[model samples]
Target chain A: MRRIVVKVWEFPVRLVHWTNFLAILVLCATGAYIHWPFLSTPTTAFPYVMGWMRLAHFVAGWALLAGLLVRLYWGLVGNRYARIGTFFPYLTRQGRKSFLGVLRYYALLSPRLPPHLGHNALALTVYSGIFAVMAFQVVSGFALLGQADPSGTTYLLTGWIFSFVSNGWVRFAHYAATFVMGAFLIAHVYAMWVSDLAERDGTSGSLFSGYKYGELEEFEDFGPRPR
Target chain B: MAHDPHNPRETALEQYLESRGVDRRSFLKFCTAVTATLALPASFARKVAAAVAADDRPSVIWLHLQECTGDTESFLRASRPTAAEVILDYLSVDYHETIMAAAGHQVEEVRRHTMEQYKGKYIAVVEGGIPTKDGGVYGCIGGHSMVDVVTEVCGNAAATICVGTCSAYGGIQAAAPNPTGAVGVGELLPSIPLVNLPGCPLNAPNLTATIVHFLTFGTLPRTDSLKRPLFAYGKRIHDNCERRAHFDAGQFVERWGDPGHRQGWCLYKMGCKGPATSHNCPQVRWNDGLGWPVGQGHGCVGCSEPGFWDTMGPLYERLPNVPGFGVETTATKVGLGIMAATAAGVAVHGVAKSIQLRAVEKKEGN
Candidate 1:
């Protein structure tokens, strides 16, 4: 079978993905340090460790938010694969079938891989959920930060979150979201590797190179299927 | 200083203070203390002094329900001008249920008289949660339910002051499974301008500063969304903790009586809610700046915050569980458990996939 190289991800999508990846990494590490402060300095004068960690967390948080905004913008105007409509697998009969096929493959009840140039239905659904979690992290992060200086700009932006939930619960949700992101990171990497291995396609590499090997027919109807 | 006996405004507060043996200098110092406590500039001290020394002393009606009388006890222990001066001279406390010399029907009569005479002029100070379940039978005063009493008293007051965690945010009585359906004074009387001095036992200086602010400005000081005075309850305890350096340095007290604990390291690990609790306990201290809970080698229970009794617990744990979970479980526990399960699932799936691949390879070779 002749493999066709498909432009699955655009330049903007790849850039945002890598930036978000790095930002999430930094945020998780710094956030954990802020929560538990596992490391201790030799002297009492080293007060800036936690301070620096908090600063890094804030910077990375803003970076992630920027990355999300750019990605969301691209999702509206970018190529077929990058569009937000591609993420909702439940919207089409073919997509629903492919979702079940992918589930069957994961359950070891099927041997054949689901045919897709970009993400399979199950992968798209998981990515959609991950994005939702990321959005929550951003909101909760700002809410928690706003409490630090209630009169500042951050508070003005995020003080309304306190009206719905207490700061402690917000902190809890933030922590829970971090764990979700962490678990998603692990599963996402493993699934990407597995997909690449089983399908003999550039599934993992497509994230970096924006290209994937697939059948030529898969490129047709690239946008979301008409409901 | 000699006062003109003829002028009513000239001699009212000053004369009263002098009669209590508090001279002009002492009274001015008390005013300065109140100004400082309210986080006002040094210039505001004279304004506070003038306000307190004014002839028309504002009337205050203090009511107690479903509380331990701790707020009044803390007030009595205030160092500046003393609690007696605060009640008698500072604001002419017309009827404090705890300290008033009147008994039974006489006290009720006095309260009614003051409320009628000074309608929409006196301050209504509430010191406990108002039970609302079953017509608020859980808490009552002189056969009057707390809900009815609060509604009635606050209806004809200039402003209401919730003087403790109980009245401010329902305190411990309003904790989990709130049998009486107790709620804070703000919940009971949302329309009235209110100030919440939300401590386990309300902070004395906070109450005094709030009263002085009302007397000085003819209105309550600016409050947070929780109706707490911004000046006193603005900053988090963690922000101004004496052991904050230790927290920043990552030196936490792991256990009570440990070397780190004895050496006064951060209590972050020992379930200190200081990081989340917003109060000026560190700055103001308790019992006239003597010491606070964290200062005395104990973590803050976050008694000053709303819903603290329910949400800010497992007092010895770092974080409380997410609200909906049946059993108490920390975020770390739940997060780590889910992550561990995912890791295990991924490992098993990988092994299964590898085995299936090997079997297929063997079958193809055959």
Candidate 2:
């Protein structure tokens, strides 16, 4: 088997990935605390428990939004593997076949799998869904934030949401999306690990190093499958 | 009484006050209090007094639609109606269905005559919701549907002041499964300008202060998009809550009659809607400024907001349920349950995948 190493994930893409991961982690943790104050600090001694949690949640929310914006922009002008089309791989005939193949592989119905150096079709499509969910979280989070001060300029921008849904629902959706994102996180990690183990080619390490080792024959990508 | 055109009680407010033995100093003090309520500079007290004392006073017609008369009760039974209520006489209220002695056809004539005389220039204070279903047969006064009354009276008035949550956002009548198909005055008169002072029973001072601002400034005070006067509803109740220190301190009442409850800790955990509800209840308060809901150790029901019934409830719970679905299912419960299911599913998937991988490796070895 001839093995070759190729750079796949660009540095900006890697940065976005990690940034979103950290932001989501901080957001969920602090968001849960803000949603329900679990810790009871003494009033006089420690007056800013929820305050600090709120600040952290706000900061992480902004970070997530920033990372999402960067990723969205990069999708427009990045490498083939990093472009927006990669997120909707199912649009291509080969991508659809690979998607089914990936599903079959996960279902343990298939042994041999179509080789892709980057994300498999299923992973990419799910990532797109995760992105959409995160975008909704940001929008709903802003609407809730604006509820804090209804007369301010922030309210003026985001208050239009109240025209559609009330403050409680905005809050509920934002909170619920956390778990949806959490579910995605677990599934994503498991899928990546399975892919790395099957390929034995640093597929998981590629997240950090941006390089994947594969067979020269496997480099066919979605070109024509095997003749 | 009735509007006797031949023997008009056309006394100016200052003359009426003098006749009633109200001293100028106290009246000025009242004006200053009104100025403060309007959030205007104290120096504007004289300007406000002059505007209020003007010979040409605005005729105010208070309408009662599909409501509990709670707003009217609050307006009449204010804690200290002495100084504050002089402002009411200044408004020269032409017609109030509840308070006016004239009833039946005579009062109807009074309302019609007032609306016609002050065509395009009378303040219509609406106190309840208007029934829209079945041609507004749900609520009527003198054989006239509330829809027609509001459309006709408020249609030609200077502005309509929706005095309660019922008249502003349809109150309890507009809650889920709204049988009467009740709607607020603004919904019926969307073309006209409106001042919506929504509350289960709004603080009477806000109503009086809004009228004073209208009379003094020759235009309504600046209002939010909901048409609520910013002076009253510019800040959230939580922002000015006296127990805010407790909230920031992480001290909250875990349950009713607990140590935190006795200690007067924050009621946030008690489903207080102060964080989301915007009103000056914490500032103006109720019952003569003696105390408010939070002050009396009760959580705010968020009565002043647009749809407190549907949006701000279940009143005693911190967070609301799934909106529009009408269930007690909380977001946290549903969220945690899904996460746990995912975790379990992932665990099962992990074990199965690992076992399958071992089996595949054994097959390869064979």
Candidate 3:
């Protein structure tokens, strides 16, 4: 029954979030098929199955890469709350305290929750780490794909990574990383669902409609506002 | 077979082979092949020749335990010029079971006679695994258990060579529950030096090269962990496969008569265990260097490896349940294992999430 006059994650951030979610889902589905092709299907459709899997994997990778680039640009040019400082939690002691404070709250040891006008320092740290890991996956996946095309530039640059990791180890890491990603997905969905349930009015709308209704201090403002 | 310090110029190997009437050219060719197989320096060939010419021919006792005699048959079938015959004779076959004209009591007497005569000077070539289960009842020769015979013979020999998968790694007989409790010579007797030449019916060239190395060096050649000579079993078949180019290009034979199949693409999809198996079959081939399985349009069955008949089976079919996305999709073992784990994890996570939600609602109601 309260209206929040705060901004949390502007248009670009919301757009990146939804697009990346869908892309990652498609990528993981196709990647699993590529990694271990199920033989239960009786059709002689080997070619068709592999082609779509590869196409979807590459397309999703490129989209995620693009989204990352846009986010990087926003990190420098966006508002105080939308800048790299918001994502980088260890910049100041207050940021560190809030980060550790929220972790304790999640652990149920803290009676008081942390406050901020952007991603809680804990959220910022995790999101940044995930981005770094995704970047690694992209590099590794392209290196493997590039082996087929002799003249591919990505192959030339990253083929050494492929050789370095070894085909068996590379494939292992790719598969293992998916479970980590999937775990993050489950936790992420649960958190979103729980947050919506707790706040009720317009809280979940920010991802789809880019706005929400809540108390002034109920949420962190994550972007610029016209004076 | 000691190196003669007395006459340097008249090296021992040259004199010995000359006595056997092998010309200089033939000796040199054999020397070169040895160098190539052992991956020795080119200059080592002359030394090898000198070594062979100088050293007194080391005696060999080729024994037949429980086997189909397929390995000896393979060697005997060696074509014109009969390299197998030449190599066997050249090495001085002090004793053999199938090839020697003497049989029955004379055959048994000759083996015992040679074992006593040569004693620590002869190499014991074992052609099959020793069956120990049921008092080693599965196979016996001359009313003696194979395990007892191998222990008695190999006990005083200079070195032992297991010449087939049956001898080296207990081939088909050792598969699964291993009813016979068959074990290779090395496992049966650990004190003696051992070399394994593992193949379904072992490669004759590999056997010849090992003998040549022993004759040439007056010592056993360097071998890998499996007691396989490094020169022959060092590289995986996949690494040297002629069809490897197709694998790298992602072209695989999905069906018996598909376009990829007709084009002679990689047979990885057809249960070819070449990636895991190691041998020189892809290079040297078989039947006196004529053709191997892949050449006949059938995928490699990985016959050279230990327990291949059991682990690398379902022979003609590709890997079970590999998820293919395109024209030539072949799923590897790691791929299938990972996906199965992922699916299981997701299912558990979903159930946990539902349980947590209900707990949360109960707490709120309370």
Candidate 4:
């Protein structure tokens, strides 16, 4: 066996990855403030703290949505490892078995684990769920934003959401999605750290550098990935 | 019921008001206010005055179904100033079930006569929800279900006006797990043109202005998707809220009777749905220009929105009760719990991974 580096995440994927990370961070901070403002001033005074917090939240929300759109586009036309198919690991019987193996390993039932050059079966599946939630957040966020000005173009596009779900629940769900994402992020980072430590591989560093190190064959191969 | 459009004997509203005691000046002032509320230009006040004083007024048939008659009580029992008097007189309400001197079957007969006489001409003002479940068995009058009654009444009318939240969007009766399956007039009469004035009991002036707009424009005012007139429901209460300065400053009344409450801080923390609700309550108050709920230091209950009773609940709290978490748990509590659990899971996973790493490294060394 020999060690060689394989480019896994493309440049656009990495760009969107960090962009969404920063966007989500800013969004959570500013969203929490807008949800329940922590800052205080005299009632007689108009410091516009809530106003600024709302502006920041809307800006960050837009950034996250933009990053998501870019990622979705890349998923359609990116590498084999970066394709949208990678996000659905349980669609096939082989994929389901691979998913079970990853799930069992994470449960600590077995010391052995399945390894992939890109995302493993479970990681991609979880990423898909998070992406769905993120999409819902964008829709619900825009729906609420459109409410501030009912006659505006934004309302023309998003006001139909109120016809399905009640207006208040949309707001509650958007706030809850942040925490759901937060919990997923905690597990995601921890899982990556453990995998990097256990495999002695560049799983954690793969996000930033778009490359992963592994030993594949008698000949050193740096191609797409090992099937 | 001797109403004729071009009757030479018909008393014009202006002549009638002048014959009683109301002067021209007070009546025009009322017109100005109505036009302003309708978001019309200052010049349109004259048009409103002309419409109000023009020959015979539109006959209104006020129907009462599953309601408390709070709307009628509020509208009739108020201060009855000259402005309100002009509105009351201009309405020409033909058959109000609660206030009409004629008894039950006689009024029903009168209603039948009016419907026949002014078929596709009279304005039907429905005041409450109509029960539709179990063949609309919950509420009935003269052995007829309210659904059928409203269908028959509003069916032949030119246009219908839903006067309260009950009639607009199935108010308190349509709250969660609705027993009777009560629904609004809009839902009952889909084909009929409607203007919804939804408040707990809607501001009488809003209903008055809606009538004035109909009389003036010869068409219903432009409405939002919910059928509420845009002039009233177009802007959110938050944008026009007097407490907006406090909201911008982040000074919320954290709890009831707190220092913030005493000092008249923003009621957002008290679950004021004003931010989400659309109404001119802060401008056109309840009970004849007296203090409104917020003016009296109570948070808005969002009475105007469709199905507000269900959508804007845990009414005393800042959020709608999160679904599936029971009634007590809020998103903040649930979110904090999820975060704490995630933190704990991460810590345990970290410890487990370190132990596994040590075991593997020791085995490799051997």
For each candidate, give its TM-score against the true structure. Answer: 0.93, 0.93, 0.62, 0.92
After TM-score superposition, the amount by which residue B301's alpha carbon in candidate 2 deviates from its true location, in angstroms, is: 1.5
**Candidate with the larger TM-score of 2 and 3:** 2
For DockQ, the strongest prediction is 2
DockQ for candidate 3: 0.06
Which scores higher on DockQ, 3 or 4? 4
Clashes of each: 0, 2, 21, 0
Indicate the residue-level lDDT of A19 in model 1. 97
DockQ of all models, two decimals each: 0.55, 0.60, 0.06, 0.59
lDDT of 2 by residue, A36-83 (tens): 888988756777888788889989989999999999899999878888
Per-candidate fnat, comma-separated:
0.52, 0.69, 0.00, 0.67
lDDT of 1 by residue, B227-278 (tens): 8889988888998899998887778887799888898989988889897888
TM-score of 3: 0.62
Error of 2 at A64 (Å): 1.4
lDDT of 4 by residue, A89-194 (tens): 8998867887998988777765545656677789899899999998898888988888879999888888888889877788888888999999998988888888
Candidate 2 ranges with C-alpha deviation above 4 Å: A222-227, B1-11, B19-22, B41-43, B90-92, B322-328
Model 4 misplaced regions, further than 4 Å: A43-46, A218-227, B1-11, B133-138, B142-144
Q: How close is chain B to the truth by TM-score, in each candidate? A: 0.91, 0.91, 0.82, 0.92
Clashing residue pairs, candidate 4? none
A1-227, model 3: which lDDT tens digit per residue? 34555555688888888888888998889877655454323234343555566688999988988888888898888766668767788888878888888777455454334645455677678888888878778777776566444245876776677435443345546666676677667656655554455344444676676565555544533333422
Q: What is the lDDT of residue B340 in candidate 4?
A: 89
Docking class of 2: medium
